[model samples]
Target chain A: MSELAQALDTLARRRLGGDAATGLARMTAGATQEIWRFMLVKDGAETPLILRRAPGGDRVSESATGLEIEASLMEAAEAAGVPVPHVKWVLTPDDGIGHGFVMAFVEGETLGGRIARGEAFAEARKVLTRQCGEALAAIHRIDPAAFPTLKRVTPLEFVTQYRDGYLASNWPRPVFDLAFRWLLDRCPPPPENPRLVHGDFRNGNIMVGPDGLRAVLDWELAHVADPMEDMGWICANSWRFGVEDKPVGGFGLREELWAGYEAAGGEKVDPERALFWEVFGSLRWGVMCCGMANSFRTADPSVERAVIARRTSETEIDLLRLLAA
Target chain B: MQDQPTPSEILGAVARFLKEVVVAETKGATSFNVRVAANALEMMRRQLDTAPAAEAAELASLKALLGIENEDEGGDLATLNAELARRLGAGELDLKTPGVADHLWATTLAKLSVDQPTYWGYRAALAERAAPTET
Candidate 1:
């Protein structure tokens, strides 16, 4: 058995009520992290679990968000009525599982393409989009002061930090530099009141079921900042999955999302500010795609990732045109 | 037009061959190595397909936009890339001007295939945004 499997078996015996069965199925998305679905069967009842581990190749930074923090945040969000899977266990460096955490395996449709295509969840898509907005509002409503363990960064500064980080990497993209200048020249001030922000909240990161949203998954990039950050992120064009016409992850309209947010007692969002952040979000993703391209150039060369990265330039151009307008 | 394989073309061919053959063999190895190799191959393929076209197009566009008649002397990719950045940094290209929108549209179409519906959707959106408001 592999080291991860053995460690999981140990963890299963310790935490779960039954024997753990491991099967590796490839999740279509997630460029920065590897996701594996782990199945646990105890007392003839099978429980599905998700294992998220760090990238195996070259280390970009030792300070990458640890899995323990992710698990803790998920648990907090779940407790706060945010739809998220239950955290079962967190594996530490000493656990020999290589920086990962185990959570109850969420059963739902995750692939954004499928969701955008409305193949499996046509009716669920409209409901889930509103639910996504509601869930995002719930996440943003979480008091940052309560979660002192989570990192705090101003929402407006996210754009600068991302731009500077990508620029410092010295990737061969002048468009990114242009986008950075545009972002800096038009940087909106951070929200008056900060709250927990899921840095990577979008349709793809969310899981949906027949009932509605199963869970908002992937908290690796979670942070505390303007709630609008999540709003802008979900509305970013890249997440629309070719259905740019349907702004809310190609499922529903933005007004419907705002309606859900307002119903959830969330603060009214400024359209102009949301537009700025939406542009910023697209630009940030463009730089990230450049980083992925750089990764392909230097360390790992996954065609899937590279192709995805190359397509980011289109997004960059799109944002530039938006800002130029 | 028939021509000899350029350096970028040669690299692309090699990358395509590797993706077709070598990548499949490395699938069962350490995921890290597999990902690295796969990405490298794709990057190489992209460089082969895009690098030359990108270099030539950027130079031509810059020169035409700036009305420069002199031939570009930069031979190496780094030098050309840096020169393009320098030119762009000088504020020679303004994407906000009237005709520049058309240029931006053309450039976008060139980079992202014109055939992509998303590209045209974006163009239409931009056009709608730029249109004069009704009283």
Candidate 2:
């Protein structure tokens, strides 16, 4: 057995009361996280569980909110009616597996393109927009006291941050320059009651079923910010795949998402501020695409990383669509 | 001059091979990556065909926007683009300026033509440009 499998077996033995962790396989889902699928066996009973561990082996950046913290956030989110994988065990120092947690494996489609276009999700498509809104409202409604450690990043702070990122990238793209200028000039004030914003709410990050949304995935980017930012981030064209007309994750409109949010007890939707963040989201994705491209040269020079540089222009065109007269 | 069976022609062959042959042989992650590789090659082939003219057009626009007389002296497209970005960042030029918005729009459209012509945003921009509508 590999060291990871042994540790997982140990972890299963200690916490899950399972004799062994069998059928261990690495799942290639999230690019930056280590996802392992395994079945824990205890007394002839089997339970499928997923292990989400830190990436890059012992290089947890300062921005990482710690796996324990993420596990706890999932617990709190479950309480707030947000669908998430139930975090079962957090690795102790004795496990020697670095930072990670085990959760009950979620079953659903996570592919953005498939969810947007596949006939399998045809039923899910009808209710997904409202469900997403409701889910976001629930996530935002979670008491801040549950996660005091999460950083509070307002629009202005992140806009300036992306601008700095673009500058550091030394990109000569004029659209990015114009986007930074436009966002900085019109940065909205932080919400009166700053809520827990799912910093990376989009199609791929969400798991859906034939019925509707199953669970919202990827809580690593969770932070405190305006609730509408969630709505706007989903509406960003980058998340739309090729279905441009259905802006809300290429499944529904912004108004429908806002309706679901409001119906679920979120604040009245501000179309203008949401539109601003939509623009903000586009530029942010653009800068992040460039970041991936930058890493292609030194850190990881895979063909995948090299070609992602071309996708930066996809975000550029998205920005133009939003900001153009 | 570059010889016949040019760089683009070679890329086209490789892309066809990957899409038709290599892709069928691979499975799982390797298959997905082979597809990505083939698409990248196709994108490169498209860029080779379209990018030079687009770059020339963008250079001409940048010179006009910056009010420069000599292309040889004013620096190449990359440097001129850097200046444009800097000026925009510093508030020296803005959308109100005659050529700023148009230049930005045209340059981005040109880039999409080479980078991702099938991208939804690119198609939308093309459609909107073809017919003005309240979208």
Candidate 3:
């Protein structure tokens, strides 16, 4: 048996006593980690559970957020009325499984392209923008003081981080240079009330059901930052997935999203802040593309990463559109 | 001179084969790989068709904007661009600088023409440029 399977079985026994884990199998090789789906047979009942963990070993190294913190954040968000999968157990060194947490498996469409273009989601798309805005507001309402360990970043600091990353990538495109300068010049003042920012809140990170929004996944990049950062990221052109007309995650308009957010008790959405963050998001994505290519050169030589590098030009054009006026 | 089938044509042929044949036969991750491979092939084809002239024009603009003469020995596109990026980062060149915005716009538009002509932003910019003047 694989080390993960043995660990899950042992952990399952400890948690469920008589009802042991019957089967554990690999699910998907996600971008950052490995996902495993297992079944626990307790009292003639079969319950499905999902385990998300860092792939290599017991020590979590590569991820920005540790599994323990992610579990805690999920619990906090769930308590704050955000839809997130119920975390079942957090793996410890004693559990023999690598650092991870098991949660109830959520069944929905997570693919952004499919959610954007698929006809089956047409009904759900009608209300998803508002739902997404409401959910983001709830997420922002989570007190940063509650999570003492979450990184607190100012707007200027965030831009500086992107600037440093772009410089470190060593792939100097003039367009990126122009964007860095422009973002630096247009940096907004730090917010007085910084809230929890869902750092990667966008179409793909969300799970959509036929009815409407189900849950927000991928809390790896969550931090304490400007609430408007989340608002802008969801509306960034990159997340539109070819539905260029629909500004908010290819689902609806900014007005609808903003209205929902305000209704949900978030501070009035700032259009200028959102726009700045959109531009920032695009430039950050460009730097990320370059960084991915740099990593491909130094580490994993995957074809996907190589292809992603070519997409830097896409962001260049996007930057021009955003900055031209 | 090269053979009748030029490099660009060769790439186009391979891209078509991958998109039409291999992609249809594959599933899951392999299918995704085939698609990305085909896209990269097409991008290479477009670059081969457009890069030389684009790079030349870009180099000329960089030379003019930065006021570099042949005596300095830094007219190549890569070196000139690296220098330009360094200057921009250091605030040596700003939007107020003569020809800086025009150079950036022309160069970026040229790149988009080759890299993603159908991109929404590129198309919108093109339309905005060709729109009828205000009365």
Candidate 4:
């Protein structure tokens, strides 16, 4: 058995009280983390669970909220009526595995392309914009004061980090430089009422079923900032999956998203601020594309990241549309 | 002076093989990756065919905009771009500066031409170019 399987077996026997766990396979090809779905059998009953963990040891970066913290965040969100998979077990040292948590496997299509374009999701697409808004409202309603572990960042701080990241990549795309300077020059003042922002909230992070939005996933970049950040991120062109006309995850209009957010009692939907962040979001994705390519040369050498590097130009054009004529 | 097939032709041949032969043999995620790999080869082919002229134009624009002659003489595109980035980051040049916006627009358009000609934003820009000029 693989080390992961053995550890999972141990974890299952101890925590889940399962007789066996079979069909351990990777859920997706992730650049930063490993996700595995398996069936735990106890008394001839089967339970589906997902294991999420960093591939290496716990060298948590400043931006990451850490797996343990993420597990706790999921619990908090679940309790607060946000749709998240129920976390069952958080790894301990005795589990003899790297940092990770296990949760009840939520069944849905998480692929952005399918969620945006597939015919099967026609109904889901109809409800996604409003559901996305409602979910964000629930997420933002989670009081940051309750969870001190969640990083609190101001707009300036995040912009500086992005600028530093671009510099670190050393790719020297001047268009990114222009966008970065533009963001710095126009950085919005700190929101009067800061709330929990799903820092990476967008198409792929959302899981959808034929019914509607099933679960909001991937809290790795969750932080406390302007709640509008979440709204702007969803409207970013990168998440549209080529359905450029539909701003809300390529499934619905911005007005529909705004209406949904307003209906959910989210802070009055700020169109101007959202537009600003939309521009910032495009530049951010451009920087991230370069970062992925840099990772291809640096720590993680994956063809996926290498291909994504070429996508920086897509963002460049996105920036032009947002910033210039 | 390599032989007759040329770099872009070689890239086109490999892309065709990946799309036609390898893609047919593969299934599931590998199939998706084969298509992505083929697309990357197409991008490379475009880059190889277009980069020299684009780089030369970008270099000339950078020299004029930054008011520096021979600043990039001993340097490559990456180095010259890094210098420009440093200046832009330091606020020495901005949209208000002469030629800055035009240079960025032209350079980014050049990049889209090579990396993603069919991207919606690029297509929109092309449409705008084709539109009749207002009085």
Candidate 5:
């Protein structure tokens, strides 16, 4: 049996008070973590659950948000009225399941390409943008005090962290240096109140359902900082998926999104500050793409990642142009 | 006059041969050699395909943007590559300046040439997302 199946069986007996129905299937998309879908039977009914685990012999980064922390953040966000997947249970490191967590399997479409193509989701696209804005506002409004385990970084410090992290990686590229300088010069004053910020919020990161937004997924990069960082990241041109005309993830207008934010009682967003973060978002992605490519030398020699690294030059260029503008 | 093949041209021919013959034959041959050969082949192919064009374009653009009209002493590919590397390493590119847009456009084009479909798809997605929201 697969390791995941064994873990599921063990967890079912220990926690769910039943037996695992089957291994079901595994979904492999994330380069960093392994995600599996399984079914558990407790009498005659079946409950669907997701299992996330670290890859073979790999350990989670020290700086990364742990599975327990992510679960806590999700719980807090849900309590604050944010639409998110209900946390089932967090598997402790001693569970022999590696570092992972179990959560309710929320079904929805997550393909950014399909949404951007304007076919099945054409009618729902306009509403999805507004939904994203509202969802983000709800997440930002979460009380940091509610989640004591979660670490908070000042907005300026977060910017510095990204800047220092990329440079310290020792990948020599002049464009990144330029982007760093621009980010430093344009650092917005720290937020008056720090709030939960979804570090990787974008079109691809969100799952959209027929009704509207289903659940916000991938909180592995979550943190507490300036909420506008999330707004700027979602609207960055790199996340727009080639539909230059549709700035809000190929979905709706910025004003529409902002309107939704205002309705959710979000503070007035500064356009200039948003632009700065947008540029920084692109720069951060550029660095990540480069790192992904470099990583192919060791773990996961994916052609796709190598391709991604090559494309970072383009993103870097975009950031440079934005900085210049 | 018979034009001799440049170093990049020679490498390109070898890469093409490897992709067409060796890579295709490897499917039936051996698994161990498959991944190693494929990765090495890809790197070689990328270098062969991109290096010359990238170097020439970068030099021409930099010269034009910097307005250095004098004939470049670094005419050969090696010298040009070294100079480009030096300039980039020394942080002379000035990415925050408006003039960097030309460099960015050029670099973007270079990257677009080699990036896989997923990268293009992501770019398309980002552009689509940004369009309706553009003010």
Candidate 6:
């Protein structure tokens, strides 16, 4: 058995008292996490489960809530009536699988392209923007008082982090330079009552069924900030998957999303601030793309990372488009 | 002068083969990586065609905007861009500065014409630029 397979077997036996872990296979590798799917056989019953862990036993995160917090946030999200896969177990050192949690595998199409354009989801598309808005409102409404570890990131701090990373790259991106200054010039004052922002709320991070909005995934990026950040992020051009006309994840209008957010009692949706964050979102993704390429050169050498360098130009154009309008 | 199958054509062929053959042969992570690999080749192929002209135009525009003549030795694209970025960061140049926004837009659009021509933002920008402007 492979080392990970053995670990899974041992973990299943120790944690769930399963007889064995069968059909173990790795899922599509997320940038930071190793996802392994297996069926835990216990008392002749097979339970499909997923192990989401930091790569190489190193706690992999950048401005991320730790795995333990991620699990807790999911539980809190479920309590707030957001769709989520039930977390089955949180890994302990005794389990020997490093830092991560086991959760029930969510069954749905997570592909942004498919959900945006697939005929199967045509009906779901009609209401998905509103659904996403509602989901974001739920996430924002989750009181930060519950989690003491969570950091409250101001809009300026968030932009500065990306700016620092970009400047460190030592690559002179004129468009990026302009975009950063523009964002800073118009940075909105921090919200009177900051709320939890689903930091990576966008198309690829969400899962959808034909019925719609099955699970809101990848909560590690969650932090306390202006809730409008979530609103702007979903409307960012990168996540639209080519359907840019529909500002809400390529399937719904901005007004629809705002309406849904208001219907769910979210803080009043501000169009100007939302636009500010949308521009910020493009710069953020551009910085991240450049960072990936930097990682390929300086640390991790992967084909995926190297090619991503070209995508920085994509964001450059996106920033120009956003700013031009 | 070299061969009938030019370097650009060669890259395109290889990318197509990977997308058609390797993707069919592999599943999951390997398949995804192969697709990205194919995309990289296709993008490079496109860059080969578009970069020379676009970069020349960009360099000319950068020199004009920065008032840089070929007196000193530091005129490479990267070095010039770095200077421009530094000036922008130091508040020397901004969008309101004459030709700054236009230069940035043209150069960025030139890059997108190679990297992601089909990207909606790129297309939208083209459409906007082509549209009749207010007097």
Model 3 residue-pair collision total: 0
Q: Tell me the tens digit of each residue's lDDT in model 1 across A1-325.
A: 7666677777777766567656645453344677777678677677777777765522324434567677888888987789998887777665666766777777888788788886678778768777887888888777788767666777557876886667666744555555655666667776678888888988788888766789898787877787887888888887887686788887878888888887887889778777777877887777777677677777666555566566665675667556554
DockQ of each: 0.21, 0.75, 0.60, 0.64, 0.22, 0.67
How high is the lDDT of residue A156 in model 4?
Answer: 89
Among all windows of 10 consecutive residues in model 2 chain B, the one with the lowest summed lDDT is B109-118
| Per-residue lDDT of candidate 2, residues A1-325 (tens digit) | 9888888888888888889999899886555678889999999888999998887444565666777888888888999999999989887778888888899898999999999889999999999999999999999999986788898887888788888888888768888888888888888986789898888989999999999999988888888888878888898888887887799998998889999999999999878889888998898888989987788988888889888878899998888777775
Model 5 sits at a Cα RMSD from the real structure of 5.8
Interface RMSD of each: 5.4, 1.2, 1.8, 1.6, 5.7, 1.4
> What are the per-residue Cα lDDT tens digits for candidate 5 across B53-110?
7977777766655556776654554444344434543456554445555575555546
Model 4 segments more than 4 A misplaced:
A1-3, A17-19, A56-62, B26-34, B67-99, B132-135
True contacts kept of 3: 0.62
**What range of 10 consecutive residues in model 3 chain B has the weakest lDDT sum?**
B69-78
Question: Which candidate do you rate higher for TM-score, 3 or 6?
Answer: 3
**Best-fitting candidate, scored by TM-score:** 2
TM-score of 1: 0.78
Per-residue C-alpha lDDT of model 4 across residues A1-325, encoded as one tens digit per residue? 8878887887888997798887799886665677899999899888899999886645565567889989988998898778999999999888887788999998899889899999999999998999898888888888888878787888888888888888887778777877887888878999888898878889999889999888999999988899988898898988888887889888989888888888887889868888878888888888888888767888767666787787898898788767766
- The TM-score, computed over Cα atoms with residue i paired to residue i, of candidate 5 is 0.78
Q: List the residue pairs that clash in candidate 3.
A: none
Positional deviation of A39 in candidate 4, in angstroms?
1.3
Poorly placed runs, candidate 1 (over 4 Å): A1-3, A19-34, A55-63, A92-98, A169-178, B1-58, B64-93, B114-135
**Which window of 10 residues has the lowest lDDT sum in candidate 4 chain A?**
A55-64
As for DockQ, the candidate ahead, 5 or 6, is 6
Error of 5 at B132 (Å): 20
Q: Candidate 6 regions off by >4 Å? A: A1-14, A17-20, A57-59, B1-35, B69-74, B132-135
* Candidate 5 overall lDDT versus native: 0.70
lDDT of 6 by residue, B95-121 (tens): 789999889888888788777777777
Candidate 2: deviation at residue A144, Å? 2.1
Error of 1 at A296 (Å): 1.9
